[model samples]
Every structure is written in structure tokens, then in C-alpha cells.
Target: VDDLCDRAVKASFASAGQGSYGEVSVLLTNDLAMCEFNSQYRGREGPANVLSFPAHLRSAHSRVEVEPLLWGDIAISFDRVKYEAKCEAKPIRDHTAHLVVHGTLHLLGFDHKEMLDIAAMKRLEVSSLARLGISDPYSAGVNVELSAL
Candidate 1:
């Protein structure tokens, strides 16, 4: 899981034009904990597959250079991942990989709040997943060209 997450984070950062060095904390929890987090943070009722909390960095002038910056935190619901994988008819590993990439992208300031934004973010996500040998998760009749990513 750690190795797959490392690859996903690296692929996401590379696709988003970020440096190789960085830090991201990942939490693998079950639905009970995830449900609480969803309610507390997102104000949603149910657990999400994954959620990202970006560590908004201070200004460049106020920080000191030392090690890789702590990008953010990502919480993934194992229960949700399993359920979604079965429902979507995708391999569990692939689904997990896609979610990790998705959460990493959110930490990098990417969002899918709007139509255009969704397209752009999805492109980057698909590209990153491709690097990990995972197919696009949104290939539900909507085609996304990898070359454009």
C-alpha cells in the first residue's frame, strides 16, 4: 500500500509540474471513522472514498528551506474503496490507486467544482494513473485522451 501510494503521489506531482521532493500523510481507515471525518470536515452524511486536506503553506519569505514541504493529508475509506471497486467492476488495486491519485491532485490545488475544472482535473488524474498502469476511472462512456493530458 505504501509503495503504491508513493508511486501515485509521485505520478500526481509529476503530472502537476511539482518537484520530486514533498511529503503527504495518508490515513487508511474504515467506514466508521471515515463517516465521522466526513461529517466533521465536509459536513456530508456518508463516507467518501477519499478526502484530502491541503496544508496551506505560508509565504516563501516566512519559511525556511530544509526538507520536503508537507503537502497535506489524505484520508481513504477502505470500506468505500471495496464497495466502489465491486460496483464499478474495477480491480480493487486499480480503484485504490485512482483514489490516491485523486486525493493527491486535490492537495496540489486541483478541483472538480466546475465543468471545465472537472475536465482538466480528470485529465491530469487519468494521466497520473496511466503512469501507474491503471486505466481511466471515468471511462463510463466519456472518453479522455491521454495525449492531451
Candidate 2:
């Protein structure tokens, strides 16, 4: 997980055109835990594959001079990720990498609420996954049931 996170973070930074210090926490847990978080924060009732909470709001008023950018936290459900990978015929490692990239983009303020924004985010995800040698998860023939980031 550590190695995967390292690669994902590097890809995220490159995609965002950011070269400064930043940190994001990634939590890999079960469906139950994910469900709790989903309900508590997103007002959704199911376990999501990935959920990101940006720290921008928390740090908006901070005046610290030496603080690294606290990008945010990402929570992922292990069971859901495995199931989705199997259903999509994608390797688990690759799928996990893709989720990290998706979540990181959210932490950086990317959203899929608009078509144009979704397109831009998808391009970044594709390029970042390519850097990790992972195929495009949204390509034709793959299931697209995964929720928007």
C-alpha cells in the first residue's frame, strides 16, 4: 500500500502541476467502515470505492509558515475495490492505483459535477494511470457503474 500510495501521490502532483510539499492520507478498510463514512459525510447509504475529504477548509485560516499543504484524506473500501476490479476485468493493483488518482484529484478540487470538468479529470486520470502502466479504466467494454468522484 505504501509503494502504491507513493506512486499515486507522484502521479497526482504531476497531473495537478503542483511541485510543492503536500500530504494526503489513504485509508484502506472494510465495507462497514466505508459505509459509516459515506453515511456520515456524504449522506449516501452505501459503501463507496473511494471518498476524499479535502483539508482546504480546515487550513484556510492557518497562518503557519512551515506547514506542508494538507491535501486531504482518502477512504477506500477493500471489498468494493476488489469486487469492482473483478467485475471490470482489471487488475486489483491497477484499479487501486486508479482510485488513488481519482481521490487525489478531488483533494485538489476537481469535480465531476460538470461535463467539462469531468472530461478534464478523466484526462488526468488516464495520463496518470498510464504513467503507472495501468490501462484506462473508462475505456470501452469496461463497466462504468463506479460513482463519480
Candidate 3:
């Protein structure tokens, strides 16, 4: 977990191409725990994939509330990741890297709520993964059906 977290932060710094000194604390747990977290925080039904909990909530907390520049904790459900990797016919490492990058971008405020924003976020994710020596996980050339798994 420590090594993966380090890689995730390094990946973020490399993607941003800036002097960002934020840490990504990683937790690898079961689907049940993640499902509870998702229900409480995201109002989701069940476990999905990676979940990012940003540490610094500026609006809700003040200067005396928490750390000055704490980034967040990224909780990854290995079960979900494993399932998705098999379903997508992608290497688990590559799939996990993609999700880590996705969660990092979320912490950095790169959302995909709109069409243009989705494209921009996808581009950034692809470029970042490339820098991390990971190919685009969602390239359109794969002739695999996710449900068939």
C-alpha cells in the first residue's frame, strides 16, 4: 500500500508537471467496507470501483481545522479492480494505475460531469498514464464486452 501510494503521488506530480508535495494515503480493503463508505459519502447503492476522499475541504473547514495542504486518501477496492481488469481484458496493474490516476485527478478537481469536461479529463488521464508507462485503458479498439465477463 505504501509503495502504491508513493507511485500514485509521484504519478500525480509527473502529470501536473509541477512542485506538488501532496501525499495520497492508500487503503486496500474489501468491497463491503467500500460499499458502506460509498453509501454514506456518495449516496451510492453498493461498491463500484475506486473511491477518493479529499482531505482538505476549504469551505467547510477553517485554518485551525486541519492540515494546511493535505490532499486526500484514495481508497481502492481491490475486488472491484480485479473484477474490472478481468472484465475489460486489461492487465490488473494497468487497470489499477488508471483508477489511481482517475482518483488523483478527482482530488485535483478534474471532473467529468459534462461532455467537454469528460473529453478533457479523459485526455489528461491518458496522457498521465502514458507518462506512467501505462497505455490508455479505455482506447476504443478493444472488442470486448464488459458484461460477458
For lDDT, the strongest prediction is 2
- What are the per-model numbers of colliding residue pairs? 0, 0, 0
- Compare candidates 2 and 3 on lDDT and give the better one: 2
Task: List residue ranges in candidate 2 displaced over 4 A.
Answer: 57-68, 143-149
The TM-score leader among the candidates is 2
Q: Kindly list the per-residue Cα lDDT of model 1 for residues 1-149, writing each as its tens digit.
A: 99998999999988877776779988889989878888888787777778888786432123335434788899988888888778777888887888888888887777766688778888998899999998878877633221110
Global lDDT of model 1: 0.77
- Can you tell me which runs of candidate 1 are displaced by over 4 Å? 57-68, 142-149
Each model's TM-score? Answer: 0.85, 0.88, 0.80
* lDDT (CA) per prediction: 0.77, 0.78, 0.66
Ranking by TM-score: 2, 1, 3
Which lDDT value does model 1 have at 30? 94
TM-score-superior candidate, 1 or 2: 2
* lDDT tens digits, residue span 1-149, model 3: 45655675667656755346656667777789888888888887788577777775432112233333667877778888788788778888877777777777666656666688677767777887887788776775653211100
Ranking under lDDT, best-scoring first? 2, 1, 3
Angstrom error of the Cα, residue 144, model 3: value is 12
